[model samples]
Target chain A: MEPILFTLFGAIAVGGALLVVTRKNPMSAALSLIMSLFAVAALFVLRQAHFLAAIQVIVYAGAVVVLFIFVIMLINVPENRLPIEKPTVYRLLGVVAAGLLMIEGGLASRNFSAPATAVGEVGSVEAVGHALFTDYLFAFEVTSVLLLAAVVGATVLAKKKI
Target chain B: MMGPSAYLILSGILFAIGAIGVVARKNALIILMSVELMLNGVNVAFVAVGSYMGDPTGGIFAFMVMTVAAAEAAVGLSILIAIYRLKETIDITELSVLKW
Candidate 1:
């Protein structure tokens, strides 16, 4: 049962990612990204990180992807106006580099050992909140400040004028 | 349960795909999305390790990564919007004034 679920979600994640890269339209790509994000969230659940899965759905699939779609609509880049250039040297280079990275990363991960069972109830919201408020308090506070800065920056940058 | 290596390898593949998209795509928006993909890949790895090691700290770090990712997406998209307003196009290849 577990392996079946894993395979299903894994296929969704990888397949959606492929669509995100291959699609020419920004809106289509954004939609595919949503699929990929949802699949990743499911994978989180499979790993027993329930809270992380929820956050992934809310922040990523909910907010981030919607933001991308909104921008795509705002710009409304005409399909014909886009260059639609033929494959070039950069495309080849990108494939080669990506292939090498995959090889290296796969080799490194070969020694990883699976945990027989979850060590803690880290998947629960309470457990995560406890850690966030206690052990990671400083980092959490810093993240709040970072988010505030990002809000201000986005508004200032996106506005029509000062 | 699946081994940590499986998740890690999946992350590697996803990250590589994101990297390829970043390099191959011309649109700044697509590149930003690709950046998000790479970040997601890293998050998966963090969670896997944290779960395997029996430490919640890895999950904590993944939370931080998500926070940073949100910030990055907000700021990056805004910058892309501003750039489009200025140049009327979002293709990074043709808008290379920074190629000095």
Candidate 2:
């Protein structure tokens, strides 16, 4: 059962990611990215990180991809002028590098084993909230400050003038 | 239960694909998207390991990573917008003003 679920969501995510990279149209790529994000969210559910999964769907697929789509439309680059490059030697090199990395990862994972402890319904929002406030309190506050800075920076950067 | 190895392998493949996309894509927006993909791959690993270890720390870390990723996407797209305004093209290859 677990293996079947993994196969299903894994296929969606990997396939969607491939489409995102290979698609010519930015909008289409954005759509495929959303698909991948959703699949990742599903995988999160399988892992029992229910809260994180919800956040992934809401923040990533809902907000982030929509944001990308808006920017894509705002830029409005003509389809004919889109920066679609033909495959080159550099791209081939990229493929080789990726293949090497994948091979290394697969080899490394062969000996990987889960710890003896069971995860068992421990990733609820309440548990995460407790940890976020207690153990990770400082980091949590820093994240808020970082987000505030990002908001300001984005506005200033996107504005016509300072 | 699916072993951690399966999840780790999937994350690795996703990350590799994302790295390739970053290297091969000339469009700045696509590169940004690829970076997001790489981040997601890392998030998957974090959560998977956390699950395997029976530790909530991994999930919290993944959550933090997601927060950072969102901010990054915002700032990156804004920078892309500024770049487009300046050069009228989002092609990283074409925007070689800083090269010389």
Candidate 3:
């Protein structure tokens, strides 16, 4: 049952990713990205990182995906105006290169072995939060600053005549 | 439970697809979305490793990655919007001002 859930969600995740890349419409691609993100969140749940999974859904699906769709709507590109994506030789080469990279990554993944350690479920919200505030406190504080900068920068950049 | 290698392979596939989308796609928005996908692939690996290691540090790192991803998306889309307003097009191939 456990492996089944993983396989199902993992396949969906990969399939959604493929849809995201293949879909020409930005809205379709963005929506597919939400599906992909949701699948990843589900995978997180399978990993016993329940809190992170919820955060993933809230941040990624609830906020970021909506932002992408909103912009897509705001710009309102017509179907005809969408970029003409032809299958050029160079693009095919790029695909080949990416494929080679994927093969390499898969091969490398096989050699990974976790060091001998306690096999316990440690992804609860409390556990992860403790680590964030205690060990990763500096990084946590910096993320807030980063987010503030991003918000301000987005506002300025997206504004007209600024 | 599935081995970490399975999850890692899945991440590899996701990352590969994202890299392909970034390189092969012409639309700027799609490229940004692909970047998100790549980040997600890494996040999966993080959580998977963290779970196996019996520690929460990997998950902590993933949380940070998520934060960065959101920031990146906000700024990247803003840049995209700015580019569109100036050039009135989001096709990446034609907007080659940074080619120098």
Candidate 4:
């Protein structure tokens, strides 16, 4: 049962991700990205990481991809104006790199051994909160600062006049 | 039956596809979507590892990655909007102002 769910969500994630890349329309692409993110969140849930899955959907698919779609709607991009150049050399290089990466990944995967079972008390929201406050407090604070900087930077960039 | 290795392999393939999309796509928005694909691939790998290792740190890291991805999309789109405003086109080839 778990395996079936994993395969289903994994297929959804991969398929949606491919659609995100293949779609020509920016809105479609953004929507496809949202689908992919949601599928990934589902995968997280299948892995028993409920909090991460919730955060994934809320933060990534909910906020981020919507922002992409919003900006896509704001911009007046004509489909015909897009560059259609077919650079054979670049495509060949990309294929070669992808193949090499797959080979390396397969080789590395051979060494990965799954632990006995998924028994972790730290996956609960309470445990996560404790760790965030105790061990990862500094990193948490830094992330807050980073988010503030990004918000300010985005505002400045979007504004026409200071 | 599927295992952590299967998930990891799928994640790798997805990441590679995203990388190719980023390199091959001409539209900035499409590139951004490809970037999201890559991030999702990483998140899958993170969760899979977390499950296999019996640790929650990987899941937490995936959450962090999501937040960073949001920030990236916000800032990237805003920059794209600014560039579109100035040039009236989002084509990367035409934005070569440094070309002599």
DockQ of 2: 0.78
In TM-score terms, which candidate is top?
A: 2
What residue pairs are clashing in model 2? none
Query: Could you give the interface RMSD of each candidate, to one decimal?
Result: 1.4, 1.1, 1.3, 1.8
Clashing residue pairs found in predicted model 4? none
Model 3 steric clash pairs: none
Please write out the lDDT profile of model 2 over residues A90-122, one tens digit for every residue. 799889999999998888778878778756665
- Candidate 4 residues A15-121, lDDT tens each? 88778767777778777777777877887777777778788888887788778877877775777866564665766676678778888989988889886774675
Residue A79 in model 1: lDDT: 91
- Please tell me which model should have the higher DockQ, number 3 or number 4: 3
RMSD of each: 1.3, 1.2, 1.3, 1.9
TM-scores for the candidates: 0.96, 0.97, 0.96, 0.93
Q: What's model 4's lDDT at A105?
A: 88
Report DockQ per prediction, comma-separated.
0.71, 0.78, 0.78, 0.66
Instruction: Please give the CA lDDT of all the candidate structures.
Output: 0.88, 0.90, 0.91, 0.79
For candidate 4, give the lDDT: 0.79
Q: Give candidate 1 regions above 4 Å deviation.
A: A114-118
The sequence of per-residue lDDT tens digits that candidate 1 reaches over residues A30-79 is 99999999999998888789999999999999999999998999988899
Q: Taking the tens digit of each residue's C-alpha lDDT, what string does model 3 give over A1-162?
A: 878998999999999999999998999999899999999999999999999999999999998899899889988889999999999875797689878988888777768888767667678989988898999999999999999999999999988876
Higher-ranked by lDDT: 1 or 2: 2
- After superposition, the stretches of candidate 2 with alpha carbons farther than 4 Å from their true spots are none
